[model samples]
Target: MDALPTDPEPTDTRPTDAAPTDAVLDRAAGAVIGSAAGDALGAGYEFGPPLPDDARVGMVGGGTFAWAPGEWTDDTSMAVAVLRALAAGEPLDDDRTLDGVVDAWCGWAVDAKDVGNQTRAVLGGLAPRTAAAARRSARAFHDTYRRSGGNGSLMRTGPVALAYLGDGREGDLARAARAVSDLTHAEDDAGDACVLWSLAVRHAIRTGVADVRVGLPWLPATRRDPWAARIADAEVSRPRDFDRNGWVVEALQAAWSAITHGTTLVDVLERAVRGGRDTDTVAAIAGALVGARDGASAVPAAWRDVLHGWPGLDAAALTDLAARAVRR
Candidate 1:
């Protein structure tokens, strides 16, 4: 464990047409970098049990896959695919752009250190490799096996929020989140979690407040009440209680539970990593939310200095890419 600030406060500002202030830029960049940081931190503990409260946690690496220290796993790699697509002026709303994302994913998956089971099955067998085709494969995989409610989609969802920020289009944000998630996770639960998380990240980027409930209205009516209750439960429960941390619903619950109980960015991420199974994914999810609220400057300097992953990105490179994404 590391030092955590006490209740870091969020800036009170919204996205504007003018060049973003440093605080906004930091938060935007933080959302991506913080995610990678947590992913790398938890990578070493991928399938392990919860650590004792006082146990040390760092970017040790070498888990289910022997990831290098401070090297992010599939979680950040996939998010980078999305970020690269957006940074290149590709809007995820367009089929062409989504297909570009899938192509990036397939290209990366070939050499990636690890790939989620649900995502691998869909991407490996994709015929056309088109976004539409990927969706079809995802649905088929889900239908035949009834196993698409995994956390793969949610783990890479944070950056989708960056695409529509300051555009004043919450509707587009929700749509893009759902569509992007559907490419691999055709389940309704998967899409719903993405919508909620994307909007939640957008809200944090804009107003500096972290509230997953912000996207509840964007979900179908029947889901609203149930998700609301889930979110409420997360706030009051402990992260370890949601033992099935691989499922989308429980994943969100575990992450939110950690975020709700922790005060600073480091604290939230620590709580998430200590939640046991699927450590990296849960920590990555919580990291994005906390980073949006706290900004990049709030991340521990030690962690940021060493943070890195696929596509040859280190901390500053990731920050510049996020800047491009926000400015674009």
Candidate 2:
């Protein structure tokens, strides 16, 4: 592992704000590709504390897990699984869609070089494709792991937001986000972060601006106030200020801290990655939202050119899924 910085400077937030309209395909492609790029960029530095200003910090890959350069981990792979199911026109709330996603998740989890503990427990014991089976497995995992507030579900939820674009009500989107998240993480905070983050993604994709506040109305009263407070906190904090160790709440705070503070998509992702702990996931989560806000064009060409991940997907393949997902 490379030596990392013990103290990083606060992110500079002075870029001009621009909300450019883009084709749905470009926005969708941006969401997926941007996420994969962030994951790949941060993969090489996972858990290696922060980096000094002079240190090299692009997508060099090969870290604690030694991934190939430009290879994404489970974060993007799981989102692709959801996108594959949605591209087939399966309804979000239907058992068929959920079953297909669960099956895909099972396959990915079995072969994934990096799966979260909560996700591993839930999908590790999955049986046939039924709602009952999915619920039972998830519940069992929750029982075994009492404090299951991992960020596993949030990292994979970007596509779910895009899939519902222009088609469903905010409530529908929230339900879908919550349902999918509950499959592996049964905690309220986990589901809350998914709904909040997905809503932010959806808003960015539709309007080309990264304002998480747009999703506030969809949250129930119980969660709305708390999340609003958290979002406010993010606007003023540094990425390192939040715990980046995979806890869902802290993960959201970390990602949002980067998102709200950075002026461009690259700025957000780089800040998230440089913050160090859980680098890939934090950057991946920020990538989805910032990518949607700025479109695929915002992602650097160098990173996008080599982005690839599990299930043998390159940028083109992921972008194809994004296009198909939106067309459906």
For TM-score, the strongest prediction is 1
Per-model TM values vs. the true structure: 0.94, 0.90
- Which residue pairs overlap in candidate 1's backbone? none
Model 1 has a clash total of 0
**lDDT score for candidate 2 against the true structure:** 0.79
Q: Rate the local accuracy (lDDT) of all candidates.
A: 0.87, 0.79
* Runs off by more than 4 Å, candidate 1: 1-15
Tens digit of lDDT per residue, candidate 1, span 1-328? 1121222222223546678888888999989988888899999998899878777788788898988888998999999989988888788879999888898899899988799988999999577879999999999999999778999999999888887776556778888898999999988889999989998998898878998987877777777899999999999997788889999999999999989999999988888898889999999999888898899898888898888888888989888889888888
Q: Which lDDT value does model 1 have at 170?
A: 76
Report the lDDT tens digits of candidate 2 across residue range 1-328.
Answer: 1121222221112221222224656877888888888889999998878765346678889998889889999899888888888877788799788888888888877767898777887777677855558778777777886777899999998888766676344667778998899878878888888877887787777667777776666555667788889888877888777765589888888888888778888888888987778999999998998888888888888888889887888998888878777766
Q: Deviation in angstroms for 18 in model 2?
A: 24
Cα deviation of 10, candidate 1, in Å:
20
